[model samples]
Target chain A: MADEQTTLPPDDPVRFYQVGSFAVGNRLQPLDLRTVQAAQDRPNALTCGHRACQGCGEALGARYALDAAVRATDGRLVSVNATGCLEVFSTPFPETSWRIAWLHSLFGNAPAVATGMAAGLRALGKSDVRVVAQGGDGGTVDIGFGCLSGMFERNDDVLYICYDNEAYMNTGVQRSGATPPAARTQTTQAVGPEPGNVFGQGKDVPRIAMAHEIPYVATATVADLHDLEGKVNTAMGIRGARYLHILVPCPLGWGSASKDTIAVARAATQCGLFPVFEARDGEVVASTPIRRLTPVDDYLRMQKRFAHLFAPARRDDVIDRLQAMADRNIRRYGLLEEAAR
Target chain B: MPVQIEGSQAVARAVAACRPGVICAYPISPQTHIVEGLSALVKSGELPGCEFVNVESEFAAMSTAIGASAVGARAYTATASQGLLFMVEAVYNASGLGLPIVMTVANRAIGAPINIWNDHSDTMSQRDSGWLQLYAETNQEAADLHVQAFRIAEQISLPVMVCMDGFILTHAMEVVEVPTPEQVARFLPPFHPRQVVDPDDPVSIGAMVGPEAFTEVRYLAHHRQMEALEVIPRVADEFREVFGRDSGGLVRPYRCDDAETVVIALGSVLGTLKDVVDERRARGERIGVLGITSFRPFPRDQVRDVLWNASRFISLEKAFSVGIGGIVSSQVRASLIGHPITNSTVVAGLGGRPITKASLHAMLDRSARDELEYLEFLDLDRALVQREIARTRVGTRSGPAAENMLRDLGAVRSTPH
Candidate 1:
């Protein structure tokens, strides 16, 4: 698995400037072509030495987004964080893991707080100081949804980023508003008849965010650093109520290998389970074509949260149901380049 | 100049005078009129440079205040009853982060039975929210307190809640000396927050506090609130000097000296209590009244000092701690430690129940004779409660007690659900 390349066709046109043909970094790329991450002073926004699990997708996702945001704003981004795994793990008393200006308010009020910060800056005539508010799936999709929606509806000048890890990862992997169907969370256990999470529930925040008719709404994953950074930069480029949702895989919550976070995230997007695209004013402007589509198990089989469906008689019915979801997303977003194929 | 205006209008005017930068408002009744007036002022270009945000909910209202205040914009908002409860988390956040946000709480009863009138339950529920609480004795005081709330909150970098009785104060027009903008400007200078969300100096304003610093941070907030005990009186005195009125203070003791019976209370109920006390004074009964201006810093020592010589004191309050008796009474008891004065608690005006002058007269006369119970509810229908108690004992299931009471009183026009 370690030696394998991405499960995409060679002619997919998704080029990677790899390090030693294995690692992702700036080794031979030209200065401007390279990501801000490859720069000498790339604003190590969530700096090193703080506590984040090994191969944490959220950590990578935040690093990409904030660096791009910091670059876009020219070091004038005051980030308001919602209390979750990212805030808890990155910062602990008297010590912080953030390089840029950051604030960690309560879980559900990040958007409103960011709104306030934007209003504050507006009032204080500090328009240069752009506001970026970030939170986990629980914070963004569930608890903080009202504030987020208010921020969107008000068209507040904020780039709200939701690091979607599917469940309440920090608080023992509880089911959240963004938890995928047929997934086992602490709250939605595997012992139930229908087991895991129910299908008809959970919010499609990217779509809901689009419904707000906000200036910008986009979805990205840590597996695609360039896409993630590109979306963040695009969001920062806009002025009012922008949202960038990143599906960052949690090894701890998902019960997957710490080293396999990026792989899992990549599989989720590639499997068409999590659509990667951008939208403006409630209309879909672009969808990242699925270079290669795989069964939902290609993503779920790696995570232990979905291990129940695999072992003790495979739940093919559930798997087919999930695969149908992926297919629906594929068809809806036109994720496959069928004509090109 | 003095003008007759509703408490809400007065507050709106005072808030305008304070020159609030961001006003995130949601219309909850009684609290509605204040924002209405402010919105009108903003629309008419009278309140310029203010961002009149029409938020969807009370939570957003407070969150907007938190955001606006965090960025060094003077923020203001208003709520009452369940609206206050809805934004309880943001209420704590505003004070916890030490954002100098000034909010007007048209104090209303929180509900299970759906009350929309005056009570202290709203603010009482937020007693430990790390905010400075001020209750107004009159519509005039309610209006004037906003001017002082901004100054005090900014000075300490903590949020302030100026509470006035919902509907009663908010609706009732009174002769209030609405201070001119110049006078308000002289009293409350531009908000100079101690800390702000500045990109130039990027300090993480609200960091995740772990075991190590969480206690110290909380203690620091507690210490700041203690400092408010001193700052409250000074701010009120300074307010009086500038505004030409003795309105805002920790406690306003009227004829308490050489008194045998003193009555202490919060909000506009004190005016009625004061009238009763003055009547008793004319009858040569040693009685007085003390209005608690600042409820949260409790004003314990001032209350203790002023009521020192009284033979007995009664805490007539709008809300109680349910099974624990009086909310303010419990604090009053904790404050009057060394004194051996006989004290009683009059838990009145709950769930929008009115506290009338006749009832206060009877309650005060009972307290004068030391015949008042340790805890009493003013104008309570004991017959209804007793009937319910007896019905429960005898196995009568008439649904819930409130419904049963309504049925017992012949007020129910429809079938019990």
Candidate 2:
């Protein structure tokens, strides 16, 4: 997905302008401030040339967060991934675009495997290094939820990152526990009276993580690379069982154009559906406020999965339920920026 | 260290001695005492520096252990019967990820009738979960094998499940010569995580592999398991040198060489069978017992080589595959298909029924008559069950299908017992 950009320096200068806008990035402003991903000289942790569909928010979120993590640690990280779309599309056999030390764990046990790694490192007296376990929504929200909670409850010395792509895209666009209500997936058909995923079902994993009273817990969207990177950097600063759940929209799974990954992810947050927030010691300590409130329908109308919601007759009830759900999230997390009025 | 201990406590001591960094488990019948001992150990600071996670359910137990192991910890957990089945998904993931986390499985039967008791059905059901499965014939062995299980699992980078007979081994107490931490440390080195999460050299793990490479991945897991055969022996030899006990490493045989009839089985039932064999030996019957300690690696060659010369082999197992036969019976038949001996299978002691030495002796004696084929149901009490069912079915025409079938056969002459 890379094109030769023979322009100024490879690093995006926009990061510099945006650095002072947040408390997180400002901490690293004096330290050369090179966007690790933009530095062509450095390794692309999630390297280029892999079949992650266009506008694949998971891919973008993973890359930006990992690159920033690479930059944060000065190149001393090993990652254990759980089986899912991110794993399927990124590394197809012997060919891997990953330029980091990586191991693939089963679909439901990335946190457990990462715990082993952390323990192993401690045993070896390698205290300088840290671990980050990652998986897709299917692996994290459903299959690996118990494991994730266990890690938090015990305060394990590892960070778990769940790339929340609403459905199991690699497995033919099936519904994952992270899929929003009224969103159509291969498994959760759009033909039913309720149409799409039931509103009450599925997990609010980040809130669940918060309930564990963990050292750190945060949620971000791939739409904001700087914010995503900042969360990763912040998680790295903590030493216990930390969680960073990123809202990564899958273009293929959501049935949207590849270029709309960032847009969709951003829309998810702006519409007050997927709140961008962080929790510490079981409290919502910080949240990226929504600058402008967009209608939940605006976000849904863009994706084919939500196409049924806007059918010939238009099922406004389904849209209203979705909006209510988003509204609930907004009310719970206080997503609206104070001065947005 | 010496202490008054039940089989579960002994196993717990062994786990503590092994110095697992994380212990995640749930309470299950027969297996509860073991985790209770562990929880006590953790709370009392007897087993310090380990994360003791008391999870909500068996599923959570396994899942928690998985997370603990994933983040570079010597992880451990335990379960039995239905609890094992409940955590089936996480159990598979544990081994598939090649995490060297040790787990103790108290063997018990899966239920439809809701009976909570001893049986091999639980451990046998997960025979192919890719974890190295080890069976213990006694509480001492159960305690000791867990130490070796952790070392062997980490050495081979494969998960290991140490199976002990539910209630039989887990509930019974015996004086176990527990190893000191100093000795266990020498035997089992601290787990060195081969793959870990690091923020510095940011990497991704557990990446999804598609159908194109899934087969090869399984193939590699199989290869690693095969590698365990060699690794186990080395670890066992080292264990013996350090602890001064011959664990028999893979399989334990009981005087099978000169015997005409050999009773092959696993778990604590072998102790009873051994006594039965001794009694039969005094009666001029040349019979012996073969206790299989390792089930996953199957110990195929060792099994064949050990019992190859026996004129007849009676494979005794505690679990059945419903419409089929005994789980171990089928495995024995498959392993001894081309062997020199005639193998007979016995399905016995299901749902924690007492497996008496008399019945075991009778089973071996019956097998010696050559009336039993490759598979036989032992101590079934089928006549009594049939009579009881017939008596109940008399006035109940609306009974279940099986019961209805019995009713349909109305006055067919009851067989003389």
What TM-scores do the predictions have?
0.95, 0.84
Cα lDDT of model 1 by residue, B138-175, tens digit:
88888888988988899988999999999889999899
For residue B331, model 1's alpha carbon misses the true position, in angstroms, by: 1.8
* Candidate 1 TM-score versus the reference: 0.95
Residue-level lDDT of model 2, residues A282-339, one tens digit each, is 9988888886789998898889999988886688877888888889888888877573
Q: State candidate 2's TM-score.
A: 0.84
DockQ of 1: 0.63
**What docking tier does model 2 reach?**
acceptable
Backbone clash tally (model 1): 2
State each candidate's chain A TM-score. Answer: 0.92, 0.88
In angstroms, how far off is B205's CA in candidate 1? 2.6
Q: Taking the candidates in order, what DockQ does each have?
A: 0.63, 0.31
Evaluated with lDDT, which candidate comes out highest?
1
Estimate the Cα RMSD of every predicted model relative to the unseen true structure. Answer: 4.0, 6.4
Off by over 4 Å in 1: A1-31, A338-341, B412-417
Q: lDDT tens string, model 2, B1-417?
A: 556679998999889888877787688887999889989998999876776766667776776566556656788899988998988987887787777878899888786645567888888889989988999987778888999998888888889999998888898878788777888978887777775544444445555567888999999998988888788778888988998887737778888888888788898888888888888888888878888888888777777777777777778888767787767656666777766667777888887778898777676666767778677777765765676677676786544544444455575223321
